[model samples]
Target: MSPRSGPPLDGAIDVHAHYVTPRLRAAMVDAGHAEPDGMPAIPDWSPESALADMDSLGVATALLSVSSPGVHFGSDADARRLARDVNTEGAEIAAARPDRFGLLASLPLPDVTGALAEVEHAFDALGADGITLHTHYDGKHLGHPEHEPLLSALDERAAVVVLHPTSPPCWEAVSAGLPRPLLEFPFETTRAVASLVLSGALERHPRIRFVVPHAGAALPVLADRIAAFSLISGGPPIDVAGALRGLHYDLAGFALPRQLPALLALADPDRLLYGSDLPFTPAPVARGLAEALAADATLTAEQQRSMRRGAAEALFPRFARPGPPGAAEPRPDDRSLRGDQR
Candidate 1:
């Protein structure tokens, strides 16, 4: 881990945020019938809007990733094309700003060939920072053998994989009566993590960096239960806690006072990154983060600093440059660094 950069460096890097374009909206509309309720209206997501938010909120830089239903809506060909468009638009934003923006390429899973091909295009050609994958494909859990090749490639390259949640197999119950994102999202994330852990996906792809949203989607609360269930059922004891130690968790939609301490106990504080899940519900996660960081003064100044900024530098590394607070300009080596990591 890098040394803490201290208090003056209030530079925040949100690793779990979303970015969409008109092309993405048109793609979504073209593929799907209607926009679901509670999802934010498609704002004009430009470099200007992101920069303006960074300026207002004291966020220095944000690592941009496509949100769920990411370019994987239609046929493999259509999905691949949409993924390219989304990545190209993101690259354009980074090209113009080079400060406030970076991109995580949205992968078209279930289409393994397309995924591997896009990995090359996005990382080698467009210079995306990382890859964003939904927790599951359609309704299949990530534990399936089909995902191994993709995970293997990512592991070989040491790529950053940001996992977002999608609706589960039981869609009617989740989509109809329950809140689409509020309830189902976290549930799906938890299910995916459990499936991955049980199927030894984490063991196979240890080098791939992961940033799980919604404070790791209730993982902290259910860690013990998972372990107990696995053990009681004569399942292999694979040290789930140790595995999670290497995973990075983001503080998005996590406001409970009790949750932070539990997270601190299980995962390295340096592995926690700030996330706002912007242009979506639960606006301005910083206020909640401030409360959590301020909740425990017993934590050393260095620990607090890591929670605020240092952890992000370690995970993303592109935000380590000198800049004013809330600066939105991309670093000079942004593209190269992203490629190097990939």
Candidate 2:
């Protein structure tokens, strides 16, 4: 199908957009991450550019986050400081245009104490919409025991946690020198989710709503395999499919033609949300993806509308009513689902 030249879906809520503050770019360069996670360079970002991209792509409001190679850069103190700075910047942006933007604050992971402190401030003081967590911090994935405290706190708040994939510690041995995003990122997401399930983090902290990006990122195909392996290994039985269905997923990054179908088989259709991994994904590419999804014939009009906006509205009530100026009214049946924090 030909991609749309104009906006594809009216008032679409983009859940996977990224924002790179100038301070964050500078910090990345200083930390020798000019090309973070083996990517060519840090993408440029600003509130104005973000808004313009949203306008072109039909995004009414974008929940912004700091993408992979998150705030941490080794030093606990420095990571904490950077996390605060970027999160504050993000909050300011969201506050300036609440109708157009929302923030998913970053954290200094691998430093549980610092992360917990920032989480408190980000939610309590900044009124952030949610939090963004990298798949792995240092050498530890999200399921690592050290992160239990942070997970518990998030669960208590029923925080919306978006998982951004980063290069695993073994990237050097496994990545074959190619950029990690090209292949390893999807694998990393799968590994981190598997760890969360196998380690009982998902079961223990059921309220922490995890939004898996890239349409569950290699997970749908591997869900049963992970579950079967857990049993075969003489480990405690893990309901991997249930864990996946309980979590939310964002349709970002090459979701159609294969990934989305696989994800739908394992995930509740209502749990699907729209995501445009902007900035990192160039505007043209992001728009193309959006247009393609909009044009996909397999999804009924209602299903498309749900993925584009309704599902997100169900998750975020703030966007359910009194939408931004000129926004279209949602269909009566669109928001049938409740905002249960599952």
lDDT of 1 by residue, 1-342 (tens): 322222222566778778878888887777662353236455456666676665544467788887766777759988888888888888877766555678888887778899999898988898788888888886777777888988898888799888888767676755776546878888788888888887889998888988878777788888888877777656667787887777888877654566667777778867777777776643345444544554556357666566556777766676565553223344344355353332
What TM-score, computed on C-alpha atoms, does each candidate reach? 0.85, 0.93
Measured on C-alpha atoms, candidate 1 has an lDDT of 0.72
Model 1: residues with Cα > 4 Å off, grouped in runs: 1-9, 33-40, 232-235, 282-300, 322-342
Off by over 4 Å in 2: 1-3, 322-327, 330-342
* Candidate of highest TM-score: 2
Full-model lDDT, candidate 2: 0.87
lDDT of 2 by residue, 127-190 (tens): 8999999898877889999999999999999999989899989989999999999999999999
Q: Please name the candidate that would achieve the greatest lDDT relative to the true structure.
A: 2
Q: What lDDT score belongs to each candidate, Candidate 1 first?
A: 0.72, 0.87
